[model samples]
Target: MTTLVAIALVSCDGPTDAGAPDAERFEPSLTGSAHVPYSTSETVALLDEHTACTIDTYETKIDCVDSSGATVGRFGDKGEGPGEFLSPARVIRGPDGLIGFSDSSRRRFFVFTREGELVAEVPLHMLSIFVPISFSETTVLGAYTDGVGRAFFSAYMGDVMAAAEISLSTGDVVREWKPASVPEFPECEHGLPYYGFPAVGGAGDDTWVFMGCGPGGDTTMLRAPRYVAESPSDRDVEEYGDGLREFRRRIGADPDVSASVREFSETPRLYFLLRGQETFDGQGRLWISTRRGRMESSFIDVYDGVELVGTVEVRDRMIDFDLFDGTLAVLVERQVGPDDSDGVPDRGIDWYDLGEF
Candidate 1:
């Protein structure tokens, strides 16, 4: 039997009419200028106390900025070179203080020091691209897909994906583990045109993975599961396979139509949703963006380990966000006028002062 844990939900509706509430709401502290245009598909990571790095998908480089919001340095280019990136997927600060990035097009992973020096580049030819979680002198940790095609759709059916530790030198998998499961809605269909995938991040030896979907009162109890990576025996993997098979059976999806629908969901189209990106802070707190109502406002659920700490509803539609030190930075998108302009709207990055929430 599966046990569901009830998490207490706290709503911080940012300063009501009562002349500012006791809780501090998220307010814009910094905005990205034209020099460092924020990309809706890019991933941001804090390099240190004063610098934050983002994979500029449009510019095809890593943009590093200081606390003053000035472009300190930009590295990499659009080419098939050592430091260059072709179709860079995500950028993350590894556990070794080095910056690691994955390029799905090139089927390779690159590691660079904070000083913009490329140290290692390894070719990884896998069915699904794995997001780097952490790194050491010899190995790199990441969340990888074990099965192909329909297996990637397991998250939609409430199954825990696979993660592994790979050798940085030989490009070989060292060890793998499957985390615990969270609440999943097997009947939920893809209402939006484009859907968001599950994200994985690491802090020290611990790794966290989560999947988010739009707000629905009927599925309010659906929260992303966080698990500590552990070594498992052959029986463990076999049991997980059984659970996954059962989940797929419960969804009652035709195998052929399921593959077709998954392909269609990848088409580039305007998609609006209540849930956005998920990440972990330096303090190991899980921050997940979600919407509660049909309004434009969105809320972020902050969890310390597995316990729900607090929730804050922001006024803007959060596309993605990252936490560094005590500050919260978000990439937001707003609807623009002129119906002839298609679905492309104005987007920007906003830094927030998360004061004592």
Candidate 2:
């Protein structure tokens, strides 16, 4: 059985005073603790008041840690069997004390109990990437995409690529909704070929969809009509492309500076600034992290539904985060040492109290 739900349109023009207040500063109460030595980990989720879950991308497993930073138990391995994962992309905790794991490589969804017991395994088709927005004993709601495609870079910017409601018992998609047509910009040569999909987060019965490309590339909580403003003049785009090439060269990513510059120059002005990850707090506030500039920390935008609440700045680069019980669990990259040989930097999970906010 399949059903389609019309995408609900909401206002995106929030109040002018939505910026973070000067008096409000969110400092990490705990920093760089040697307890959780990060490796190829990308995400952190708070399971309970004292328990934190960290996903190890390299190990392909999830680590459960207590408040004292002690490893309580570990679940998952690299396999095709139950409780195993091939490419674990996202891990989310459900309201019923079940942990949902979306494995893009295997194209399957695995559910586990809080105590690390394998409960359910469902094979998913169509969507290559899955981010669970809401889950129950029988149903799972989330936003998904068929990976990167030209249609994803449409100009409308308001449409979600795809969304679904899956049945846990039958491993079937009970409902699916997709955009009718993706608007395109014929003049712009650059199409978002990478992961340019919108960010989706949900709490309780509410789900929040955040499109990456808005006016000025600012993060917007609701999907509004595509901005039809004038594209950056060709000369301006070229200048900005040159700057981007230089930055890439300095970072040692682009060795052929000339080719990089040419590539960027031919591309369209997709976004003024890149938006990062987003998560919904326990109190139903949507927190989105947007990069200020190259190699800069993230400014988190808080929203109550489509209304802008305020912003919070984090000093470190936020890879991914999770919120539980009014606590913000942030996974941040550790600073590299001069003597560090390996290119991969260590990561740590920092906790912040969002109770007062």
Candidate 3:
């Protein structure tokens, strides 16, 4: 079952009075950044202590680099031929040492080995907004966040859904995943929305979390609530958002969001607000970039499925962060203006030594 966990969050030993989650705040020491050819490295798979693979979507190539920032290898070409990619937008590591890459522009998905060997490729004409987190030679398994707004624009669907196993040949979702925790966007009905994602955590924009990593792309467990009822879930509503808010308040999140210059949550338009990202560690511990805190530095809440066991504070408003072999790689926004030189990269990846938990 998909779950918005209901677990007690205890504060870390030393920061009990900090108004943050009592979860232990693990300190991080800055390390050297991995050298990437471009600033478009978003999806990364940490291979080892000094080696990791990042997708340079700008050039449609996969780059593997070491701790010292030297390019160990580069693979993929921009073309329609075999082993070539038109626009590699997203990458996620799959089972059995395989990785999934989505070419958004060409409406194609590819599975490849770390060495850039093409394993499986599928042409999905309707694969516009659906990101393939797990796929095989046939099935395109993943989440589609746009489904939230689709039902609003088209005929309303009769059921609520978390994910879909889509087939371009059939032009429909052949199979689907349904979880009780998935938020419901009803059209005067009590059923679920057609293409909604889990939107509980104020953690960030990450839509879904994977269920269990196995041979097949089965990410039913990982989810973000894409849409909820017009009014926020009541205090008694114990869904994913409820659990996440409980955790946020414990971690020093200043509720009562300040009024903004533009449209706020009180508006009638569709809005899903969350900052930061979520990722799992080798030992199955879930680490999330904590937002809504009053501190200048960001905090990463480490969860053991059910409870807040630990937390890691970052030094900036991170774009994204990943951990590999006790090392943390944080993607930060670069300061660039119209007159900025080319040397001032648009993005920066900062490395850190993850302290003891």
lDDT string for model 2 (30-63, tens) is 4323245554445566776566777765576777
| lDDT by candidate, in order shown | 0.52, 0.54, 0.49
Model 3 lowest lDDT segment of ten? 5-14
TM-score for candidate 3, please give it.
0.57
Would you list the clashing residue pairs of candidate 2?
none
lDDT (Cα, 0-100) at 157 in candidate 3: 32
Top TM-score prediction, candidate number: 2
| RMSD (Cα, Å) of model 1 | 11.6
Q: What lDDT tens digits, residue by residue, belong to model 1 across residues 103-168? A: 766878888876678888887757776767557777777665554334434333323445667787
Which of the two candidates, 2 or 3, achieves a greater TM-score against the reference?
2
Off by over 4 Å in 2: 1-28, 31-41, 147-159, 179-276, 293-297, 305-307, 338-343
Candidate 1 lDDT (Cα, 0 to 1): 0.52
